[model samples]
Target: MITISNLKKIYNNVLVVNVPQLEIAKGESVGLVGNNGAGKTTLFRMILDLIRPESGEVISNGEAVAGHENWKNYTASYLDEGFLIDYLTPEEYFYFIGGLHQQTQAHVDDFLSTLTDFFNGEILKKGKYIRDLSKGNQSKVGIASCLLQKPELLMLDEPFANIDPSTQIRLKNMLKSMNKQHGVTTLISSHDLSHITDVCDRILLMEKGRIIKDIATSSSTLAELEDYFAVGQSATLLPQIDEEENH
Candidate 1:
């Protein structure tokens, strides 16, 4: 399980994200939703130990995560293009990441074996640098790298961006299967409410750098989500509608 206590991030002496407490149990699928600059990415980075929070603690599996020495062993994340290796080919990138994570070459081969039928041959045969590959293909490679490690916690930021609709559907199915089959806790951020509503068990709505609303999938819809981001309305409005529907 991952736990956060009084987490806060400050930029130029201004408060950004401040979560007094939050916890994600094992095998849970949670979606982080927000408008631009809502501190979603910053919070995610803190969870990955990529950036230090100004104060408070982020713990994973009973260990402090901010400077945890073994973070790579339990966490896998793909936040942006910065995670990609421009100079390496797709196959080489996989090997590199796997090796850094202490996975044997055979482990890489075994992991890719399952995905062999899923990917077209072109990505495997692309001898050129990963930077030369199309954006969609590159995203496929990045995702494949993260899954190769098979980490306990998977944090993905906008996993569907820049990919084709067909591939997006495929990825969604893959993630859903992973959650069900492996019980891997996943935290994904997306602007598309449909994506969150379709895959996530719970959703956290972030606005102006704070989580203003938290709702389970059984309690919400895409249209309601649209209104949440439209005018920065009060979250109390949601529960009232839910109450009215029950009556």
Candidate 2:
């Protein structure tokens, strides 16, 4: 559903993203695993045309993404709370997103009912604006609103961040079900190896600004990534076990 070629992004003379060519097929769940400065978000912004690439182009279903509006008709993305209107309640936000795709309020309500497990009862009818919710709750709202669109292509950056372990599992299951039931193509970028390996059909390991590893998710993908990251190659890997998070 997506093709990229000669894509490049530079910030302050440092090339942040420079992919020569990449393609993601329809109905494929792909995961991008890399530490900070790996160019995941930069690549995403370029794909969405939120940032102009230094060179080359992204093609979404045969249409160039940089100057086209039609690809967005089938795409929905959530990178952070920036995608959400903080002033709106969860219900209002979901409705607004759904309405953009011509979905009715009744349709959004029915769809949200299916996401109760993912929400864990904190998202709806709480009478709280989205800005007032906890960070994790805000993530839930963003993700749920994305799914409500029934998008053909979905991109989520760090979906696992700030979410509790239990909700994380629920989200993994929900993503899996979405792929199986609706054939939604998914792209998830994360530092969490376990969850990404468990959920994605394929994993792309990125470093600096290039894709270094592209492997099909398999029986040993987790162990292989762990072993690859265990070498403490300061040039390649981030230090494991961030101390600040523990405190």
Candidate 3:
């Protein structure tokens, strides 16, 4: 459903994202895993066309994403609280989004009704603007808004970070159902290894602005990721300490 070629983003003369090529098929659930500064968000922004890449292009359904509006019709993304309309109450914001997608208020209400457990009784009818909610609640609002769109391609960054554990579990089930049953193509970036492994069918491990590993999820995917990050932490620290000693 998405293709990227020669994509690159640079900041402060440092290349933050450098994907030579990547492709995501329809109805596939892909997980992006990386530590901070690995350029996962940058890559996502380029794919979403929120930021222009320094080189190359992203293509959705055979059309170049840059300078194109058609992809937005089928794509829904929530990277952070920045995606929210902070001044609006959750209900208002949801209704506004629903209007954009030609969904009636009744449709939105019915959709939200399915999320009672996911919301854990904390999101709706709170009578507070989105800005007043805690970060976790704000995240819930953003995610629910994305789901309201019933998007063909869904991308969420660090979606598992803020909410409580039960909500996280609910979200995983929702995403899995979307991918398997509803055929919603998903790209999720998360630091939580176990949850991502459970939700995604394929995992892409990124480091230093490039995709280093792309593995199809299997029984041992979580263990493999754990080992990589565990050893990776030590390897990174040892290099810095060695450099300091040499200095």
lDDT of 1 by residue, 161-185 (tens): 8887877787899889889899989
Error of 2 at 207 (Å): 0.5
After superposition, the stretches of candidate 3 with alpha carbons farther than 4 Å from their true spots are: 233-247
Best by lDDT: 3
Clashing pairs in 3: none
Prediction 1 TM-score vs. true:
0.90
TM-score of each: 0.90, 0.92, 0.93
The regions of model 1 sitting more than 4 angstroms off are 116-118, 234-247
| Local distance difference test scores for all models | 0.84, 0.89, 0.92
* C-alpha lDDT of residue 175 in model 2: 90
Clash totals in order:
0, 0, 0
Return whichever of 1 and 3 wins on TM-score.
Answer: 3
Tens digits of per-residue lDDT, candidate 2, 138-235, equal 99999988888888999999999999999999999989988878999999998999999999999998879988767889998888788777773433
- Order of candidates by lDDT, top first? 3, 2, 1
Clashes of 2: 0
Candidate 1 residue 133 Cα shift, in angstroms, is: 1.9
Q: Return the candidate ranking by TM-score, descending.
A: 3, 2, 1
Give the per-residue lDDT digits (tens) of candidate 3, residues 1-247. Answer: 8999999999999999999989999999999999999999999999998999899899999999888899999999999999999999999999999999999999999999999999898989989999999999999999999999999999999999989999998999999999999999999999999999999999998898988777899998898788778878544234544565588
Error of 2 at 135 (Å): 0.9
